[model samples]
Target: MASQPEQRSKVARRALLGTALCAGLVATLLTTGPARADHRDDAWTVSAPAAHEPTAHIRLDDTTGTVSLSVTRRGRTVIEPSPVGIVTEQADLSEGLRFLHRKDRLVDERYRAKSGKRLDRRVRMNETRLSFATPTGARLDLVVRASADGVAYRYVLPGGYGAVLGETSAFNLPPDASAWLGAYRVDNEGQFAQYTAATAPTGEYSDQALFETDGGYTLLAESDLTGDYSGARLAHDQGTGTYRIELADDRVQADGPLATPWRAMVTGDLATVTRSTFTDDLAPASKVPDGSWIKPGTVLWTWLAGGREAGQSLAAQKAYVDYAAERNWPYEAVDAGWYFKAGEWDTTDPDWQTNSWMPELVDYARAKGVGIIVWIHQRELDTPEERAQWLPTLERWGVKGVKIDFMDSEAQPMLRWYDAVLAETAAHHLMVDFHGSTLPKGIQRTWPHVMTLEGVAGEEKRTNTAAHLTTLPFTRNVIGSMDFTPGAFQRVGLRPNSDAAEVGLTVAYESGLQMFAGTPESYDRRPLARAYFDQVPAAWDDTRLLTGRPGREAVLARRGGDRWFLGGVYAGAARTAEVPLTVGPGRWLVETVEDGADGLVRNRRVLRGGDTFAVEVVANGGFAGIACRWRPGVTTCHR
Candidate 1:
């Protein structure tokens, strides 16, 4: 007889093969569902029952592969995906549904109270049918609704409770082919709290995504609520795959009165491929679309050189702006201490008076065709007094945005306070970038004006080495936008050195708004590297994932019309790999090779019509920004 271990291995292999077969069959069947339709001006659609029917309909644009899920009942469009595309959609009927895996079967169901009040029933995992009660005192059976676009698992609510809470999770695979999950929360207007847990097969908390809804028609919050669970929290365990979500909200909260609908997307797989593809699917389907809400480029600022009093460093500020303007970059930033050094929470610092030089920096940037964003510490802006006084003044000074830093932790009060800040900033037409903060949990979608947040120890931390840069996209970026100060051309210490290659890595790592955080002279020293910076936009209309492996290697492709940008990084030792180019049809001019101490090896080449290209690259060292143009009938070659 075979040994026990051998038998177990055989069994595991068989199970894996069986699961693969099942997955393939399911994918085939799903692909045959309804073909993607074109975008039409149809009435909005709501989650009304089949009896009442959908009074309105949401049209999907096949060209852009964008879906418009509208709420017809209220005559309002609740949520629209980003111009990119929809990743995935998962649905559930009721809250508190327990999922159980038995030896032979997988049981998932929920229950309700005898009085039809709340979900106060139990779900048992046994060799029986999955059952749950409706709010109208009726028992309903669950069914699977699969489609080509995605799978939709539906259920009926008991009673006259027309409210439904569904969790839809989407995913995108970037150039690196790393997976990122985008989870969405859908529920009627009500007080709802959704809890997401990413656990391993053993059910350990690898990550957590949460959203609390007050009351609104839409299911997903436009901006993430600032509180204990404001940012997307990651799991300490790096190997978590399985995720579970639980949502709870009374019908009263579901109603439109003092309640708002709940909606959210949660995932921690920040590989470039996942985010790019997911963003592509979620984008809105509209001709002449306006992406002003999505800030896609990098910011050139003089923070590190002058520190808190960067605004006082007028020469440095002017030089930075000149560098950005010369490169055709969009914006430059002036960090804190420009206003006044009112010890922590001192908003009344006399320096904030009309005589401050920060406002002059903003004006100077504007004159140079560059936008200026100032930084403000949270302690000063937390109170109503400070908000009313300073926010208006900052807006009056023509500040494009404010980087609110030092938001201590993930507490409920802090979350609420952050929410208020976002709201107030929006009121003043001032964009926000939360720094010294927590992770992002899809808040930028609603308040598109909220540019970026600093959750991870980004480029600002000079200690960030090339190795650390390789680990970020797969981890912190999975949740949402990271305000990582990208461009740094100075070589400081040994282990964690900053150079033009690192600046190139910033664009490659998939940051929406990149902050050029080095001396102005550094940028001047590297014009070719600066050329890449000039081309990098703060916002993107479409993103594509080419290839990647979490904490190891990642490659991404982003598109801004005719121009194409490709970036990749490797965290471990030197290695080689092939990455695919998925930016539609075109001849790509690739100017790339590993950068070493001596200089760049002239390996500028051209790539013709091909799906995937085999390229040799080093570990920790990577390639970025391959500018491609359509050269019909011409093959690309090394220069």
Candidate 2:
């Protein structure tokens, strides 16, 4: 095996090789010297693939050498001109630079996503590279890609290396724009709130900063985040309606030519924003050796209900495993106390002297076709040696997956460690669920084995309400899979939502690895809820936003296999939500679960594609259901 430094050298070599491949594809406009250019020549524009898609215009201030951009959907402004630049250790590329040359290309490609809103996707973009030289002649390139859904740009240094100090990038919202944003937390667990851009608090915000603009909606996010660069957040300037780029770390080193993560903004109406695949489109292709072993499904988790005691108890785990097998759930997660104490990783804690029974439980679960996912704190596998020492051992024990928690950082080292862990986990054919982690940047596309991530304030947070729960679909979950472990039959969080609302979340919130948070007894008590869970899928082949808003209400219909599941959540006052059945025209058998005057109710009906499925709700209520296309002679609908 090669040393860490040697592996990094190989990565650098691969990056250089990629750079070489890019050079061949790029048609560079070369110049013998600094060309004196007019303001007209300073601007370049690109439109998305479709006629109605968003268009981006990039303009360079020839005098200050600073670049800025503006965007529009249809004819209305989506973004006011926003500044873009970067500051490095050796030179300041933000201003006082010279125009060198540029390149342009049209990119169109198709790929298969192992899981997400859509199983297959087409990435079409108009790519433009604007090159510049600092006062010291250091090269900087602003690469922009305009797609049908939105536009994204990133900084690249062709032969650049050294410390990246900061960036001058900013997203300028229109004066009347109202923003929905979450505060930045190491675990990325913050509730989203609404405020006018000027009134938005001046502080760090999670990467997925969404705005309801004058024209439509726009969601700010980043993609292709590698460990080579630190994670970034939006630093809002109160009263200015401008969000500046803030790196998670003070300094990040670029060992080779640095290609920063794509600063993406997905634009359009609520449906467009919710259904866009721009994040996955911008990520790299799959890197796993074979994705056949990777499975996405629901897992019965004991920690949330039974806590550490049940998680470590062999009897408790065996019981949970038995329930999982009975329910046909693919896995059961044992959190925290199953291993050593939080900080002590090398040796088992004296409290759990008989922890060796984990292997026995793994065998027991495997016999029933259930996999066991064990949790470990971040410190346990902080280094490659620790990961190497433990990963194979767990595989040998027949453990199918790992739930690594408390990462809480996206600095260069931690980011690199994330990449390394995903790679290593895939090599061992172990699925991974990252908890206490940063918002996913489409890593699932690069490593399909990355089943899920806990970047939102999920069921674990006591402060959660229907308002916070309802906002996630448009904000946090838009970018990638979220492990917001749904299905809590017991009342949870601060102002509790209706039980029907909890049932609705199983389908509304998308996660490749959805963990049922309720206890076996809780689920057993609610037969209807259990029935809904039994049919809902973690991954989808197609998804559509049937109707609703961000924090108030959200109704989504997702297709998995031959069934389309509908889930809707409402935060405030009660009203009737009418969702159009747009899945296609045919005799459809619909089974719905919703809040009744009593506890909960289930109803079955038949509807055609053009018909509407309306449900009456109480305040802070919700609904979940399944629709199957039925044949004329079919005797029964499976789900």
Q: How does candidate 1 fare on TM-score? A: 0.60
Clashes of 2: 0
Clashes of each: 76, 0
- lDDT for 119 (candidate 1): 11
Writing each residue's lDDT as its tens digit, candidate 1 over 1-639 gives 642223433454354345433354345433432343222332222232222211223333434323333222223222222111100011122222222111123233332211100113222221212233212222222322111111112222222222322222221111121222222211110111122222212221212222111111111111233331222222222233222222221111122111111122321223322542222122222221243433445777667645765565677777778877887777888886665544543345565456576677778888988888887778778898889988898888888888888876554467668768867887787777778674454455445566677766565554554655654554445445667676555645532432434645655555555777766676666655666666666555455557765445667666555566667776556555677666666667766544545644434566664566655555456766565664665443212
Q: In model 2, which regions exceed 4 Å deviation? A: 1-40, 341-355, 492-495, 632-637
Q: Pick out the ten consecutive residues of candidate 1 with the lowest summed lDDT.
A: 82-91
TM-scores for candidates 1 onward, in order: 0.60, 0.92
Top-lDDT structure, candidate number: 2
